[model samples]
Target chain A: MDFAPLLGKANFWAYFFIMLTGLYGMAVKRNLVKKIIGLGIFQTAIMLFYVSIGSKEGATIPILTAADAAGRGGIDAAAYINPLPHVLMLTAIVVSVATLGVALALTLRLWRRYGTLEEDEILARLRGDPGGEACTPRS
Target chain B: MIQEINAAILLLLMVCAVAALQVRDLMGAAILFGAYSFLMCLQWVSLGAVDVGFTEATIGAGVSSALFFAAIFRTTRRTKD
Candidate 1:
C-alpha cells in the first residue's frame, strides 16, 4: 500500500498527537491546576491545527508590501502564507491569557476558602467534615 | 521524510500526554502539559504558521503555565486522595 499521502501530510499527524496528549491530561488529571494546564495544551493544539492549514510549501511571511497595497505590483499568492489564521491566532492568544488570569484568580479564592487545593479536601471542607472530632461531633 | 518527522513529533506528544495523565503530582502534570504546548508550537512552526507558533509559545507555554502554577499554589499541591 502506498503511504504517500500520509507521508506527505506530516503536520496533520503532529497536530493530532499534540491534541490527544492535551485531552488525555485534562481528562485524567485530578488537580485543578493540572487540568487548567491541560486545557492550555489543548488550546495550543487547536491553534497549531489552524495555523498548519493556512500554510503552504515555501511560502514567505504574509506581510503585504506597499507596492502590493497600492496595486502597482501584482500580488503573488505563491510567495506568501495565508494571513487569516495568523490574525485569528493573535486574537486567540489574547483571549487565552485573559481566561488564564481569571482562572488563576478563582483558584486563589478557592484555596483561601477551602484551605486545600485537593478536590477531595475541598469537598470535605464544603461538607463541614474535615476528618476529625469536629466532623464526627461525638455525643 | 516530512511525514516521518510529523510522526515522531506526534509520538512525543502522545508520550507527554500519557506522562501528564499518569503522574500523581499535580505540579508535574502541569509541567507536562506545558511541554505538550511546546511540542505543539513546534508543530505549528513546521507547518509554516509562525504567528500561531508564537502565540502558542507565549500564551500556552508561558502565561498558561504561570497561571496553572499560581492556581496550584492557591490550592494544595499534594493530593489527599
Candidate 2:
C-alpha cells in the first residue's frame, strides 16, 4: 500500500502517538495522580492537533497587519491563518484548566479520606479486607 | 526549516512523556509531567497557536504543576505496583 501521504502528514501522526501514550498511562498506571496527568496530556495533544489544522503554509498571523490596512490592494482573507480554531482552542484550554483544578481537588479529598492514593489499596479498604482495619467497623 | 524544529520538539515531548510514565518515584513523575507540558506548549507556539501556547504554559506548566505538588504533599508519595 502507498504510505507517502501518511509520511507527509507528520504532525497528525506525531500527535496521535502522543495521545495514545497518554491513554496508555491512564489505563495502565496504578496511581490516581498519574491517571490525571495522563488525562491532561491527552487534552493538550488534542488541542495542539486542532491548532495545527488551522494553519496555512504561506499565511501570516490572523491579526490585520499595517500593510493590509494601508495598501490600495484589497485584503485577501486567505492571506491570514484561520482564527476560528485558535478561538475555540482558547475556550477549550480554559475548560481543561478548570477541569484539572476540580479533579485535583477531588483527588486531594480522596487522599485525605483514604490515607493513600493507590487505587488497589483503596479498593481493598472498600471491600473490607483484613488489613484495612481503619475501614472495618468495631464489633 | 521550521519543520525540523517541530520534529525536535516532538521528540523531546515523547521522551518526557515516557519518563513521566516510567519513573518509579511519584514526585519525579510529577516533575517530568510538568516538563512534558512545557514542551507541548512550545510545540503549540511553533505551530503558530500563540494564544493556545500561552494558555498551555500558564495552565499546563504553571498552575497545574502547582496543584499537583499540593495534592502530592497532602498524600503519600509512594506508588507500589
Candidate 3:
C-alpha cells in the first residue's frame, strides 16, 4: 500500500540487498572461511543500516563545533546527526573483530582436527564415513 | 547531490560482495573482502559518519584482513566447492 516510502529511499533497499547477499553467501558456501566472510559482510550491512537511519540532511557529526557556540540561542540539537547509532556501531565493529578472531580460531582447530574445511566433509568425517576413515585423529 | 554518489557506492558494494563470494581462491576472497570493507568505509564517510568510517577502515579493512591472511596461510587456500 505504502509504496512511496519504500520506493523513495534507495539506501534502505541497497542495504537490504547487501544483507541478503551476505545471508546467501553464508548459507550456500561450503567453506568455513567463506562463511566467516559472509558473516562479516552481514555485520557490516546491519551496521550500515543503523548508521543510515540515524543520518540527517545538512547535519554534522555529534560533536559541537566552535561555530555553534558563536551562534545565537545556544546550540540546536538538530544540527548534529544522531550519535547513538554510531556509538553502538563502534561496539558492534569491535565485537565483529572479536567474533572473527574466535571464529577463525575455531575454523583452524576444525581444519587441524579433520584436515578439511568443507562443512560436508567435516560432517562426513564426524559421521565416520567409509572414505574419511573416521578422521585421522591428528594431534 | 550526495545521493547519486551514495547510490553508486552501494552498487559497487553489491558488486564487490558478489565478486568476493564468487572467487574460488580463499586468499583472493579475503583480499576482496578487505576491499569491500574499505568501500563500506567510504560509504560511511559520505554518509557523514567520519568516525565510523575511520574505525571501519582500521578494524574492518586493516586488522581483519591481517587475521584473515594469517588464517588462510595456515589453512587451505583453494575451495573445493
Query: Which sections of candidate 1 miss by over 4 Å?
Result: A13-21, A64-74, A129-139, B73-75
For model 1, the local distance difference test gives: 0.71
- Give me the candidate number with maximum lDDT: 3
Higher DockQ: candidate 1 or 2? 2
lDDT of 3 by residue, A1-139 (tens): 8654554476788888989989988998888999999999999999999999998878877775455555753456878888889989999999999999999999999989998888878877779794754643422
lDDT of each: 0.71, 0.80, 0.88
TM-score of 2: 0.88
**Residues A1-139, candidate 2, lDDT per residue (tens digit)?**
9755654466787788889988998888778888888888788778868888997777776665445556743556877778889899889888877988898888888888887887767877788773755542422
**Which stretch of 10 consecutive residues in model 3 chain A shows the poorest summed lDDT?**
A130-139
How would you encode candidate 1's per-residue C-alpha lDDT over A72-135 as one tens digit per residue?
6456777888889878987877887787788678777887877666555566677887773343
C-alpha lDDT (0 to 100) for residue B25 of candidate 1: 78
Q: What lDDT does candidate 2 reach at residue A54?
A: 91
lDDT of 1 by residue, B1-81 (tens): 655676677678778866766677778877887887788677767666777778778887887777777777656567531
| Candidate 3: segments with Cα more than 4 A from true spot | A1-8, A67-74, A130-139
Sort order, TM-score high to low = 3, 2, 1
Instruction: Encode model 2's per-residue lDDT on B1-81: one tens digit a residue.
Output: 677777788889988987887787778888999999899888877777788888889988888889888888878678753
Leading candidate by TM-score: 3
